[model samples]
Target: MAHSAFNRKESRGAHQRLDEGCTERDDVNFLKHTLAFYNPEGAPHLEYSDVKITKSAPAKRVYGGEATAQDKQNKEKANADDMKHVKMEVMRYNPETDDAPHFVTYDVPYDEQTSLLDALGYIKDNLAPDLSYRWSCRMAICGSCGMMVNRVPKLACKTFMRDYPNGVRIEALGNFPVERDLVVDMTHFIESLEAIKPYILGNDRKPSEGPNKQTPAQMAKYHQFSGCINCGLCYAACPQFGLNPEFIGPAAITLAQRYNTDSRDHGAKERMPQLNSENGVWSCTFVGYCSEVCPKHVDPAAAIQQGKAASAQDFVIAMLKPR
Candidate 1:
């Protein structure tokens, strides 16, 4: 109800919130990166929810002393429910006016149900009408909302805001030039997607025969690779692409894999020459980041690795057969 009370600049803030019930430390690295500017040395406050936090110092452990298991669980749950909300300071960029990006803090009343995408939408609707970012589907399927949520490539729609208890910092996808606030040049990702010839390749005979017969079992082989939504999240997450822009990246590899595994396709033999070349499938070092950041679960790393195996097999059989 009191949005103004939470809104303030970084230099001043009289109200302080305490967090409690740290269920996991897995996100410590991510939090450290997101809130680094505000709490340079260490985390300024603890992150928890209304279900968490304590009124006073928690009872200390005594050697060999233990509370009933149910009692301990109830206490832990209570601590988690008492957590408080905090502010998120986000970096904003304007290509038309500002030479560089600047930080703008927002007092986002935290709730366990809040997501980074939800927060961004709230800010855009309430705090800043001019703020720019891309989002198609509120779900991760669209992949249009992929960006750096605290320096990690992720889909804004999928990243939960409450996960970052301290605060959050959002940025455009890394390794690409920003067009404006959160949009980056997707030309490279598009071109690479095109490079692998994403469309199905067929001979004149196949069309004459009508729909090429493909069994359900056959479709199963390549189903995973075919799930690609042309999202460039894999490319942004790929260090290989960062090192060598010419590298085809994961999405393209998956594209190629999609066609190659099709039962009726013969182009796998033909595409082998192109895929085996220096900047083709061979360039992938299998860093596995592409798979990690994929919002669609289209594992480009596995596709590329599988492509290499297919290529290797082709080479072996070609050499063994008649000259």
Candidate 2:
């Protein structure tokens, strides 16, 4: 701008100051000042005119320099006023160094769009280098950011910071051993899922039995159960699992039912032993908190109830038919 201007007033050899309220610097305020024009013999002169002359409605002449300074101050104040800060109370744990887990609080600024996961990231990046947690596919698809927020199970990325006007309390998912700060050991969970035989049972087809057919209605029977992302929020919310870790848990039972209700699967018989065991579907007292906390809305409580009915039917069939 200084290079292309006719002759910037600040750099002019001999320029007459005909305008008022011109400061030492920022007098122009990026093209808001009265423009300079060249007179005869190429000598640059400041155009004598009211600042209001270029305004949408012309009436007043004001101090350009003072107005520019005041406007900058007001903008700075407004930007500061718009932002709000919250305290993130994050759980910290180190098995080798600490006897037990503890909480660390950090003051982080946030707006309505700020998520709890983002707040944790901010703290980890700026405040504490040793902070540890887990997150991936921040859109909530990967189910890796599972944690206990304010004592409730949720995905950090999906949980917003602004929602907690009074701040937030975070911990690892319940019913699982904490591996680190927010990461819980999922070995038991993985084994539980494997125990259910969560795949379709083969019918011993030589080639292909025309790829088992099913209409939309048949698919709809277990469609809701198939949406499980295996976030394990349901397991965290289940009081049954907390009471008895041996319980197969909601996610595993729901997965079992997902295949059991499928028209293309014959693995229900194989899964029935696990589902009918003392630690299987029978362990769930149907508190329904598991369904309430499931991020994907895979209703494990409903699935367990369905499994009970199936188990009862199996009992009746065994009684009716002599082995």
Candidate 3:
């Protein structure tokens, strides 16, 4: 549970250092604030290119190699050659052959540019052909390659292996029934999304009727909530979804918000109870992990929060009206 204390001075999306040593020891109580970063450049400087220029007196040109660019490239090549490989212990399960699942270790060639997806590809190509996992659109757009790498939910295409070189542990995504090795049952999540009436009920007239008019501001209001790819990473990260299976999770709730907030849709009042029901928005405790694990930047937690507020406002407005 590596975490950092919250600093109000920094923006919500700004980078903050994680005091891993202090957090593991449980020395002090500090609130953890998770934020999203789009690229590796947003990570710590050492995680990527380590070359830095510092000013001591007059900003001297300090090179670890000669003035020639090829010299430095050769030095980096030698540095990479000296690095060692590591073992990746992945959970293996086969319903047809094996009675139970077990961890299988595979020594993968490691490098700074290698990703967890790369290691898995190597295993499937050279080491083991029977290794089972779900993956599509390796660029993270399909959101199918999500898994628990070292007990943390992450996208295989985005999570680099260099950050964790010493033996790594890969497993299926949490809070779901294990279907096979590195694959989990997604039927529950799919059903939950369907339960929320995910599509827009934009029909108030017949097919020959005029189009539904909508303002630009109204489109902008729900635009941010429409980027969900239903990765199920948020459901795995959410404790509420773990406790109650009918919580609707984040993806569906965000989808509901997408429709409910749209000016062209006339079902906001009809969708109010579904979003505010006992097992719906009220079940979420604002864990905020939904937004944190979202790969598409669709902050479902914020959508659920706004849903609750909308529900409360509707309730109050109804109570104030005369009979």
Q: What is the C-alpha lDDT of each candidate?
A: 0.74, 0.83, 0.78
Candidate No. with top TM-score = 2
- Candidate 1 vs candidate 3: the TM-score winner is 3
**Ranking of models by lDDT:** 2, 3, 1
Off by over 4 Å in 3: 1-84, 97-99, 204-214, 317-323
Which of 1 and 2 is ahead in TM-score? 2
**What's the true lDDT of residue 254 in model 1?**
87
Summarize candidate 2's per-residue lDDT along 192-252 as a digit string, tens digits: 9999998879656545556666999999999999989989899899888898998889999
Model 3: per-residue lDDT, tens digit, 135-245? Answer: 888888898988998887888888888888778999999888899999999998888787767766756666678776778888999999988888888988999988987
Worst 10 residues of 3 by lDDT: 44-53
Q: Considering TM-score, where higher is better, how would the candidates rank from best to worst? A: 2, 3, 1
TM-score of 1: 0.67
For lDDT, the strongest prediction is: 2
lDDT of 1 at 193: 71
CA RMSD of each candidate after superposition: 24.9, 13.4, 23.5
**Candidate 1: stretches off by over 4 Å:** 1-85, 203-211, 313-323
Query: TM-scores of all models?
Result: 0.67, 0.73, 0.68
